[model samples]
Target: MRGSSGVAATFWSFLSISSSVLALEQQPFQFEAMSVPTYTLPPLPYAYDALEPHISAQIMELHHGKHHQTYITNLNAALKSQAEAVHAADITTQVALQQGIKFNAGGHINHSLFWQNLAPASSVDAKSSAAPKLLKQIQATWGDEAKFKEAFNAALLGIQGSGWGWLIKVETGKEQRLAIVTTKDQDPVVGKGEVPIFGVDMWEHAYYLQYLNGKAAYVQNIWNVINWKTAEERFLGTRADAFKVLKASI
Candidate 1:
């Protein structure tokens, strides 16, 4: 009887230890199977109506709340469905997902920057001016601020379809120079070996409600709210070596 009792106790103890070991073995697999990150639309830096007169409140509401939200949703969905391919670094799968990722990601990125590049015209101090360094650079590159605006507006007005006009700083040999460039669709300016200082959305949705096919007028008004302070910060913070490899490849 004593022997039988000892055997029964030992069997139960072994069962308990085996169950614990199995649980421990499954933990890493459970962790590894965790879901991929879901991207969300970021909130505007200012109120929806903060950029009013230049950019109407209704335009801001639709552009930020609806259009931008859709991009974020699609991006998250694409990333989630393609998690395995992305994790394995599969080139074919990555190529398949690239366009969708770029379009949506570009929309999100572009809109975010656009919001930061504008402020209330009322906020501008009557006596204040653009950061002196940025102003000096603009003058040097385009002869004067007026000429720069003329060139920038011309570039923006020339976009035949939905796109953005950007004022970018490119490293030329040992020095950086300002240039105006346009990108079709929702393409971003970064991969071109340039740092974008200012950008204006030339998409109809950005102005059609208020300007009604008057893209040139829309471009002109946007400057009233342009955030020169932000542009100056970007210019000052840029490092000469930041795009060294990119410049070399070019």
Candidate 2:
């Protein structure tokens, strides 16, 4: 419904999917992108209908191309506008650009993670290994996996409007625990530096046709396609970064 042009959408989708990873020759911690991170619509890791029966091809195409690309376009525009306003010292324009930057960038970051977090159910190789780690963390925090899922689902369904239901690892505490958190309308999870290891998108565009109005079914089914290796890498990466400050002193 957003960038609905077929040519533009196809071009972006292809470019994103086929684009090779940018090699970073720089040192560690150099890529701390918070305010002006040049966000791009990451290409889906598989075919548009790769996860069919769970997510439809038509829906996937529209969601990735139209919806996701619009956010990236708007975010880049906001960044350029912000730079100009800062140079010209235009307070009014500067104030207006702030909201757009955060909203659009948040949308980009959120969807980037969302795409990587999924795959065809048949493609998952480490589900058994990574699932129990998440479960143990969940149960330790919530007392049981069922209760953890219920709370997680409640957080998802309780979104009055559009937002995200996140299972964030609160690394600040002594033990690793999964916290059910909600954010309103494309809010950034790491703007203040708290890392988000997992997120469940509650937006209608995320799960409308497949499960219809069955939010619970959709939430339950999301576990099937999770790329646990990627998730574990993200978890260890974040923890390694955060605890680095502590480890340095010790």
Candidate 3:
């Protein structure tokens, strides 16, 4: 067990040093009254080597530690002064901080979904039972799961550059309506008043190394591990008052 797979060691290095935010973690916040939860990447419940073949070990390590953690680090820093500025009623200060929070926070949230959205492609069973209720919703709304997958994959692949493809629930008439949304960069789905049930990461770093130039192959493989159960929970379950979803136990 002690043979240094270079996997665990590299992961720690990426988390502790390579990540942008972890370094700033020591810088104490000047104001403590800010009502924002400091954004951070939740530790994945599985191992780096878990999602291979379809996605390489190198990509997972970099995506989780360096890319995801950086978002959390930057978001926390942005929130540090927000409390003081808001308390003092400084219009300009509060306004300026909005863009930073949205971008970095979006990065944090989107990455979280990105991680959850993937699994070892091997786990995919094309004939698995689809929850009756979930299936009914899909057929009525998007014709069928196959069609939905096609649309989802197409949208995700179409993102001009770094961003996300989302299956969101929009509010209308008294119930949440199902809709597909493509968020550019790290923008939050909630900001646009859509509740994101599932999301696909389309960033170059998300697939470039593993798939190389094979974008369609990457997209096809992602659906194999789509966490249908989690998607149901996000859709039917309740989320926190302000941007909080009780961490889904893996």
Candidate 4:
């Protein structure tokens, strides 16, 4: 029922569909029938306060528990509605439901990746050394690590409103490169041959309580908690590896 205007405000509890869920980005979510599988918010890999000093416990609790859960809740609602619309052959209702599905679904996918993309600030995974291969590609693309972070932070700050900033590994033919990209609102990086190495949630809810209006501060401190080991894995693996959590989560 936590949907936007113009959509039905009804929600239903659903049974877990499949034990083997495909990587979300690789398998675009489809609404076929009433038997759709429900999405659940995956738990954080570390404690809520694990990234302390850089990201607050309060923010992590609300961001993961409340915000991310809302996306799953609403996504289930929208998908359920889409199923009914399809059954009735009501093309109008089905068409009107796409926005909610895309927004909430993107929110779920983005946050799922975002949570795994971070580590405890003191963990070795947080260090650039944990990602030598990715670091080399970054250096090749942006001159050096410092320049890469500088460019990524600039992209984060330049976002006009709620969105995300991502460090993505792009491949074309025999060429491979690292790039910084941004997605508006709850939109996700779902490009072919592109793997999202790590993403920073730029929504005000992500940093407003801790950083207030100083989003730049939030952007900078975020580097200290990034899961570079995970980044290295994604950069070296296929796009499916970037969202491997989807295959494990309910």
Q: Of models 2 and 3, which has the larger lDDT? A: 3
Residue pair clashes in candidate 1 = none
Q: Global lDDT of each model? A: 0.74, 0.67, 0.68, 0.83
TM-score for candidate 4, residues paired by index: 0.86
Tell me the lDDT of model 4 at 117: 88
Give lDDT tens digits, candidate 4, residues 152-200: 9999999998999999978887787778999999998888878898999
lDDT of 3 at 4: 39
Measure candidate 4: CA RMSD: 9.8
Winning model by lDDT: 4
| lDDT tens per residue, model 1, 137-218 | 8899999989999999999989988999988878656677889999998997775447777789988988889999777788
Q: Model 2, range 1-250, lDDT digits (tens) per residue?
A: 1123434544554465343233222322453332343555666888899867677788789888988899988988898788668656799999988889889878877777777667787874437366545556666778986787688778888898889977676655444445678998899577333656667788888888777788778777776766665555455445333222212221
> Per-prediction count of colliding residue pairs?
0, 0, 1, 0
Q: RMSDs, each prediction? A: 17.3, 11.6, 10.8, 9.8
Which segments of model 1 are wrong by more than 4 Å?
A: 1-34, 87-91, 125-128, 239-250
Which candidate do you rate higher for TM-score, 2 or 3? Answer: 3
- The count of residue-pair clashes in candidate 2 stands at 0
Runs with alpha carbons beyond 4 Å of true place in candidate 2: 1-38, 125-128, 173-176, 191-193, 239-250
In angstroms, give how far residue 146 of model 1 lies from its true place: 0.4
Runs of candidate 3 with Cα error greater than 4 angstroms are 1-37, 122-130, 191-193, 241-250
